[model samples]
Target: MTVRPITITGEPVLHRPTRPVTSFDEELRQLVADMFETMDLANGVGLAATQVGVDLRLFTYAFANDDDAPDRGVVINPRLVLGKISEEDPDRDEEAEGCLSVPGLSFPLKRAEQATVSYQDEDGVQRRFEAHGWFARVMQHETDHLDGKLYVDRLNKRWSAKARKAIKREGWGVPGNTWLPGRDEDPFGH
Candidate 1:
């Protein structure tokens, strides 16, 4: 599988909602394999089709829980169900999140602690499962990408301003722009 170049933020495909993947053919399988390879090369936990310039509703994720047990899968045309967060839960942490599109920048974003997602597998079989902690956050992040939303859009006013400034300073707001993760020098030192 080839590692496709990741489309940066401000690209039209990254801003617009993706189309559903209706065909589960060899092409779709190849795309999934390429996405996984690209994500691994970029050291990303999750990646959406839009991030790779494919306007299809699909994403791949590779995550390990606290015990180091691995979980990896592909979600096509996913429907996400978020669990309610308890205000009284002191253990809940607003962790910093980064995106493959908006590379080199991270912001502390609060996401649902748990979520259930329904999606089709590569073979077009239906599947549903729940995720928690960092895995849950990754699912929500990738789902946002499919819906034409970015983590920077969910940032608060203070962090939003910072993100905008960084984008402008780095000249990354141009449409159709892209950068290679390891090859390019990260402005934020990642």
Candidate 2:
């Protein structure tokens, strides 16, 4: 599978909702494989189709929990069901989050503690699963990408202002600000 170039913040594809996956053919399988490869190369736990310039409602995730139990899969045309947070425990926790589209930047953002997603597999089979803690956060983050939203959109006002300034300074707010893995220069500056 080839690692596709990741689109940056200013790309229109990343800002608009993606279309549902209608065909579960070899082309779709290759796209999913390529997404996994691209996500791995970028060192991202989760990636959406829009991040790779494919306007389809699909995402791939590779995550390991505290015990090192690996969780990897693809979600196509997902529907999320968030669990209610306790009154004493706020839904918004200060946790660090980053996006492949907006490289070299990370900030603490609030996310749900639990989520249950219903989605189809690569073979068009229905599946449902629950995620908690970091897994839940990752699911939320990736799902947002399918909806044409980013982690920055959920940032608090203070962090949002800081992120905007950094985007401007780094010249990342324009389309075509992309880097291919293992070929182009490191955009994160190592």
Candidate 3:
């Protein structure tokens, strides 16, 4: 397994939808392993294929639920069915979300309180499960990446402005920008 460099926002691969995983071969398995290695090193709960410059629709996640139980695995070609988005404003303190691709900043964004995801596993076996709370949030966040949407893109006007400023200040939003875990400093402060 290798820790690949994570792409920043505005990179073409991260901004466009990825192709589905059709071959469940050893190469795909190796990519999944590399993604997990990269995600763990960067201290991210989820890392999508596009984040690492791979245009395949898959993501690796390792997050603990509200009960503190570990929920860790990979999802390929996911079809996420989200519950109604909460009308209540996102509690900034509780709902702030950050991206490994956009590191170091987290912005508040309201999201569905529950979600159900159907996807294939490493062996091309189909699976489905429901989630809630932070786990649900992770599912939604990662699935959005598959559709070429970042969490910042869904921010409201106020938060969007803030995110935009930060992106500019950091000199991001361009192609060929990446941060390698275990080599570069973790802007996410992991």
Residue 100, model 2, lDDT: 84
lDDT of 2: 0.86
lDDT digits (tens) for residues 73-98 of candidate 3: 99999998889997777789998999
lDDT (Cα atoms) of all candidates against the true structure: 0.84, 0.86, 0.91
Between candidates 1 and 2, name the one with more favorable lDDT: 2
- Candidate 2: regions farther than 4 A off: 66-70, 85-94, 185-190
lDDT of 1 by residue, 112-159 (tens): 888888899999998888788888888899999999999998877777
Off by over 4 Å in 1: 66-70, 85-94, 181-190
| Top model number, lDDT | 3
Q: Is candidate 2 or 3 superior in TM-score?
A: 3
- Choose the strongest candidate by TM-score: 3
Judge candidate 3 against the unseen true structure and give its global Cα lDDT, from 0 to 1.
Answer: 0.91
lDDT of 2 by residue, 1-190 (tens): 9999999898999998999999999999999999999988888899999999999999999997542224888999999998764434222335778888988788878777888888999999998887888898898999999999988877777788988998898888788878787787655665
Model 1 poorest 10 in a row by lDDT: 85-94
